[model samples]
Target: MVPEAEFTSYYGRPIVKPSPWEADIPAYLFAGGLAAGSSLIAAGADVTGRPVLRRAGRLAALGALSISMAALVHDLGKPSRFTNMLRTAKPTSPMSVGTWILSMYGPFAGLAAAAEVTSLLPEQVRSRGPLRLVGLLGRPAGLVAAVCAPPVAAYTAVLLSDTATPSWHSAYKELPFVFVGSASAAAAGVGMIAAPTHETGPVRRMAAAGALLELAMEQRMERSMGVTAEPLHHGKAGRLMRAAKVLTAAGAAGTLVAGRSRALAAASGAALVLGSACTRFGVFEAGQESAKDPKYTVVPQRERLEREGPVRYQP
Candidate 1:
């Protein structure tokens, strides 16, 4: 059993405050990851001549990207000032980097999806001069989007873990893997729903690998945090986390046995998507809970002070 931490604060008030941002932040996180990972899937399908999967992947990437942008702007209070995010390029600023990544990713992803959509149009429509150019530019634009996808998918973890929040900051080491795995799983889930059964082999494999990686990394993250991990496993956040784990496990198992049955594939894919959503929400909620508890802030500081034998006074 993990040792319980006890610490005091003024009037029993929380030392660290929870985020002011609402659910939209976590929703953006999920959508951004889904878009990034789906772009990668589209790139792979494009290279392998899987047109059906490629189209599906491109469309998913575009849709998710749109949702992510909407959620981000909505969370910013003054939506008109959302463009201020692009005012400066600071290497030390995760938000700045993430904004730049999105700026590049959104257009490329949109172009890719547009290209796919144009290709499916009737001959008379597709043969138009402007449309032909878009079709020609689509593959390269998508490839460029895919190149940026990994960072887009992984950067949110850095953004969250770099914050002052105890639970998120403490789990920094493992958070990237967790986020990437969840993103991959979500993208694969979208593929399963949108692509033909025969072209979904890669999607299924990615889903399984992603789920396993997320589960393993999450377990290690919680265990290593010890008492600090309590927020992740208790109360409302805990419930969501538990549900995510169950769904992820079930989805992974179903993918393995889904075979050629489109129905099973669809079900497993849906589960993985929901599981990934749960994970994002759970992580956000856990960080909030940890921030709101004085023990989470004070106990860690006390432990550090004790371990370091107190700061020596320079006389």
Candidate 2:
């Protein structure tokens, strides 16, 4: 019968514990997904006889996946416990799915990179048939990873939404789009940096799509939040989103103007990369902000418990 506001903080703790995940984890996730997608795109381009674009795509996939895997392991509660994620597939848990997705993605990406780096190796070290075989087999790894990447990138949104994180759960529809956009931008950035200007057309196109999508979703998320939106209005989340918008805009504009200038394309690519990072940071910070305020968690749950009754643990 009493008001829930009277009980502030969890166990008298003023701050909600941010997930054990470090700041790098989300960025890594973004980068990894983008890489995987790029690899698939590269393969497609190569098959279609777009040799220059193909190389760029492969490079992007490799570099992005490397950073993503590193960040992922670094975020584990017990880095040694990483294997447990693959112990079994649990549809109810996105983390478990992500683990397996990463598991398959790692080796596949490594092999593909080795295939692409034939020139980087010494004459003796340069592999031909076997390496090409690996490339052929591993070529799909990026797209394969891409299939799982969206879930890996956005499932965190669901995870936090289900928890006490403020507007995150309420804005579930927009989370996937936000993550997808960020991932695409990150991959396109890598492509722009590694490939020649003539080959970066796809990267530019993908980055523009991503930037526009993220900007639209973010604006909508802000407007849709109502009371829960306040977390995004102040502090780090606000700053990050604001910065992301500006950077995304700059990158998009630069990509349009870069034409065949590899250097200009590279700069635009860099801007997109920064923009993606900012978006990840902003989302995480927003979750933290939602968790920090007692009202955000308490009010909603209190309403649910009152209307539907406290969930009984039968087991």
Candidate 1: tens digits of C-alpha lDDT, residues 272-303: 99999999999999999999887888777878
- lDDT per residue for candidate 2 within 7-33, as digits (tens), equals 476586744555555687666656765
Query: In model 1, which range of ten residues has the least summed lDDT?
Result: 4-13
TM-score of each: 0.95, 0.82
Clashing pairs in 2: none
Number of backbone collisions per candidate, in order? 0, 0
Q: Which number leads on TM-score? A: 1
C-alpha lDDT of candidate 2 relative to the true structure: 0.71
User: TM-score of predicted model 2?
Assistant: 0.82
Instruction: Report how far residue 292 has shifted in candidate 2, in Å.
Output: 1.3
**Candidate 1: residue pairs that collide:** none
Displacement of the residue 144 alpha carbon in candidate 1, Å: 0.7
Instruction: Kindly report the root-mean-square deviation of model 2 from the true structure over all alpha carbons.
Output: 3.9
